[model samples]
Target: MTWHGRPSRGPSASVRLDLREPARRARPAVPHLPHLTASAIATWRARMLNEHGSARVFEGLARQFEGAGFEAHLVEEVRGFADEERRHGVLCGAVVEALGGEALTEAPVGEAYPEHADDATPLESALRNMLSICCLSETVAVALIGAERIEMPAGELRDLLTQIYADEVGHSRFGWRMLDALSQRLDDEIKERLGDYLEVAFAHLEEHELAHLPEGSLPPPEGVVYGLCSGPDARGLFFDTVEQVIVPGLERHGIPARRAWMRRHGGAGLS
Candidate 1:
């Protein structure tokens, strides 16, 4: 998935900048300086970039909500998530700094969100994106982050993880709740359309996640202290979240999530 509804970056799109969060509170102590490595520091820096990018994604989602004619209050709530994601980015950047890495990253060029389909209705388009963004992606995020948080000991890193995890839970719930609200109006046809899109959505989700989460041996014990995790471990958790949590949750709403998942292949069912 594409991040929908982001504004164009125009002329200065590729500028490199420190994506750090402005300090709104005291900086948390950075533990495990002795455990730091180039790779680990890079990981934290990458997280900083990812979190900042999420802001743009959420901003697009907010616009989709508006286009779908969701309630004004709920649309505004979705809009607010952009700021929260920016805060998470800043927090991750701080950790990178504390680890002696710069939070500088190239601003993504052509910052535009895509319309999932040319023929889909505004509501169908919104449903497709929301399910992909929040239900699948954010739900997986909640599980992965929560797992890392549990492995962490008391410290700034753990605290940061906790904050992010809570927000992710909210993000995931927003999609589910939105679905519930729209359920009465979904009708059989709309529900079938959504089920059809699930195959494509699940395929994209798997491809994107697997690319980022490597298949490898676990990280050393100290890596966990710095919020690092084994690629294999994270991959396992991601699949588990999709199968056990996301699929079942969607099925409850009369979606054929299991069938879609089983039949999923890259780009299937997309127009």
Candidate 2:
């Protein structure tokens, strides 16, 4: 799945996404109990907004790749990834609706741009964005989804989580594949520069507060069984994913883990 250079034709020509059947099969056999409280509905709405934002970011990345003269296959793959994200948004919206929450009709505020990208070269910015959104964010997403899945009882909610998890795994791998391919052309200095951006990207992610749960609180039975975790559990998942999955994956791809940055930020950083 590595792309050394541009391909003669794009994947859009041959690749198509059949989202309907899987989505249909993944639907819950029995109706979900409408036990969601106002707070819970709000939370689900927020998640729907996040998924919408993710779809937009992926769409932006696809355009960025095309404009930067990346391989046609890679560009098309990213485009397909954008479609997947959009589908994820729809799925999340369905959950929100089922929980008695309205779909977020408006687009989420702000946009996805890498920290320090303003002054970076176009290729550098693209790489940084790739690492942030695909590598870091999607990897965290997989872990979070897994945590939620564990607490979720067997039902439509768990089924939905499974579907989303599978897509996220592929999305994370897409980032690694691109990084591996790009490594062949990028010099050590440039790769190191890209690696440095990981710290900034991670900091930005924390600042955005994408999924922070409260400290020392027990997991809410209602939310946990419905694909949500407690504050403490969410925070634990974020850090664990970074240390266990993200750092090692980056290191394997020749990207530094920026352990110093992590240590300066908190305890037992990434050893």
Candidate 3:
């Protein structure tokens, strides 16, 4: 469901997929079939596509940061993040293949919101992109991945997920660092603008994670076994991450956490 709010300015430019093929290095063969059902395989492939798609978003952010004359160090950090995301896509593809799915080739198409808005200033766009992708999405991903890793039996899947989790922690930290640096420049107008965008970003993230399911439906059992949370668990984690981690962090950096927006959106609703 969509949040009730003013329409965000649509993406000014489309994201270009990074069509570079993953390295052709041989992967270790799985000794036995994974306990995944057809639906589980499909979920894994979808996640693979999502990971692959993220490379494009990160690349776009890197380009935007450079074009906006952000600091050289931060620009380089973003570029490195792009490379890391591409690697994550490749790793995820390997997991899919191990689980009897076809290799991922095409990156998914989507905009990183803040960078997509034509009306926003470069810094505003950058801040929005950072908040949506890094602060919210990647941060939640780290928690999800860690939970999955904990539940997964010792196997190739768990190992690969662990690697991704490590990288995600760094990526989330990068978002925070950028936000902290950028916060120094945020006047009241920018801060208010951030508050307005926070609800939109939160809704966007919720859609990304749960849009395929019918309203009030839970994730399948295979999904839980394969490291995905049930609908209730996912919803709980999202809100908890916002309230306990993201919101507090933002407030510490002098940005409003927009608690009213969360309340308005039924952020407290059970899945």
Candidate 4:
């Protein structure tokens, strides 16, 4: 199945999420139902769908890890990541209902995962996806959610954001640690291929973030209480995370990540 990129299916493609849980578990308390505007309800509903999509992505990554002969522990961790994303979906779905929105969304299509390059080896292919999903995407999630958590009032919404933030940190760390674990196998050829793929990955990252996080708009204080944030803040945090965190992390592993990022857009970074 495709690991990322859900093509738009319009409203006809919408499906209601199953929110029933047989096993009882304590869920985060959501205390702001009255504060949730229609816009916030829509945003949380979209987040529920996004979490579900992320679960599918991690499921594919788990299979990729296992097929590539990665350590059992690492494969297990990826599987756990999938489960966590599913949990996040459920959590977000509950919040959607609490905020007076239906937990319905367009389902993503299933297909073979895309290759980073035609001639890329299996290990290279897996690493490229990992770098995209975990290193860049999840890392940016940590930054964005962390900022949101701090700005949010000490309430159930903040508590929920904290939980998600912690999971994202683990996901981000897994990418870098897995890279370290496979360091010996990253021969010069593989490093070069990964470097080349970084350009493509960075480009995709920019497109994805720009589409998800708009620019020049900040949620009002009331909106922040409902877990909203500034689009411009998110955009700036994304580039800062890329430059300060991801580039340096990749460079430490002998990948020409900075160079690849510079090449991501005609040697001029995003405005």
lDDT of each: 0.76, 0.64, 0.64, 0.74
Candidate 4 TM-score, C-alpha based: 0.87
Candidate 3 per-residue lDDT, tens place, 70-164, comes to 98888888878777776766665565566565654443246443465567888788788888878888888777676667766776667777777
**Candidate 1: where is the Cα deviation over 4 Å?**
1-13, 20-26, 33-35, 266-271
Model 4 over residues 1-271: C-alpha lDDT tens digits?
A: 1111123333443455556351113245555546446767667766776777788788888888777788898899999998988877777666666665656656655445665447776677889899988988998888887877788889766777677778888999999888898877688888887888899889888887777776755667677777777778778888999999999999999898998898897555553
Q: What's each prediction's clash count?
A: 0, 2, 0, 0
Runs in model 4 deviating more than 4 A are 1-16, 20-36, 115-117, 266-271
Question: Compared to the true structure, candidate 2 yields what TM-score?
Answer: 0.78
Please give the lDDT score for candidate 3: 0.64
Candidate 4: Cα lDDT at 175: 92
TM-score for each of the candidates? 0.88, 0.78, 0.78, 0.87
- For candidate 4, give the lDDT: 0.74
Error of 1 at 83 (Å): 0.7
- Please tell me which predicted candidate would have the highest lDDT against the true structure: 1
Given candidate 2, what's the lDDT at residue 154?
Answer: 87
lDDT, candidate 3, at 164: 76
Candidate 1, residues 81-184: lDDT per residue as tens digits? Answer: 88888888787777767776666777665357766759689889988888989999998888888888899888877887788788888998999998887777
Number of the predicted model whose TM-score against the real structure is largest? 1
lDDT (Cα, 0-100) at 128 in candidate 2? 83
* Residue pair clashes in candidate 2: 213-231, 214-231
